[model samples]
Target: MAEVHGCNIPEDRYYWIEKHVWAKPEGDVVLVGLTDVAQSLAGKIIVVNLKSAGKTLARGKSGGTLESGKWVGSIPTPVAGEVIEVNGAVKANPGLVNEDPYGEGWLLKVKPSNWDEDAKALVTGETGVASYREKLEQDGIHCQK
Candidate 1:
């Protein structure tokens, strides 16, 4: 795991630093979730509204919305794809995002329309960790416990 301003940015995932989102590929589908930085910035998540399965989302578009004490905003997807799955657990208990943003709190799974083209734009591995650190500094984001 990589720590950026005290927020965890796991090296295993691909990240879109500006969007505060992460993607973990599993075969044809990619699991998507908000980063710890995002969860921290939002405060305790109160709700997560994901686009329904089978819906096609264009790259850089809103895949859903997340609400918290501090704010409510769209969760933009990094790549265009079909929503293959949406975590129902998040709908019933949004706090799951606060508890485990990368695991059980994952937002959705998408079958990317153009995986090779789109994923090339994401940051991953050691480079991604470095990017996360830079993003935190650029945004003046300090993780709040």
Candidate 2:
């Protein structure tokens, strides 16, 4: 497991270092979601509005908005492409973000037009874990651990 600022970063994820998002390869398309660190920083999510299907989104662009209590923020898409799917489960159960973020709590499914190009921008495995730690230290966020 990866940890940053005392936040959990499961090593299984493919992280978008810049956008603060992550993706899991699920067949031809990918299952996208916010990393645990992101959710913890964003607080308790209340509502989410995802880019509809067939909607075109730019790489690293905000594909949807995340509302957490009084905080409102965007979840940038890691890949440049159209939104093939959105998680209705999250829409109905916004708390799922706090429940099982890496699993059913995922946000979008992007059909990356340039996986080879964009995937390189994201960090994974040990490298990703290290990066998240560095980012937290830079931000003066100490791990809860």
Task: Give the top-scoring candidate (lDDT).
Answer: 1
- TM-score: model 1 vs. ground truth: 0.97
* Top-TM-score structure, candidate number: 1
How do the residues 31-140 of candidate 2 rate in per-residue lDDT, one tens digit apiece?
A: 78987767776778899889999998887788899899767988888888878999998999898887777887899998878777878888888898898888877777
lDDT of 1 at 19: 90
In candidate 1, which residue pairs get closer than 3 Å at backbone N, Cα or C atoms, i.e. clash?
none
For residues 1-145, what per-residue lDDT tens digits would candidate 1 score against the true structure? 8787889889999899889999898999989999999999999999899999999998789999989998999999987899999999999999999889999999999999898888899999999999889888988998877
Candidate 1 lDDT for residue 55: 97
Whole-structure CA lDDT of model 2: 0.81
> Where in model 1 is the C-alpha error above 4 Å?
none
RMSD of each: 0.9, 1.9
Worst 10 residues of 1 by lDDT: 1-10
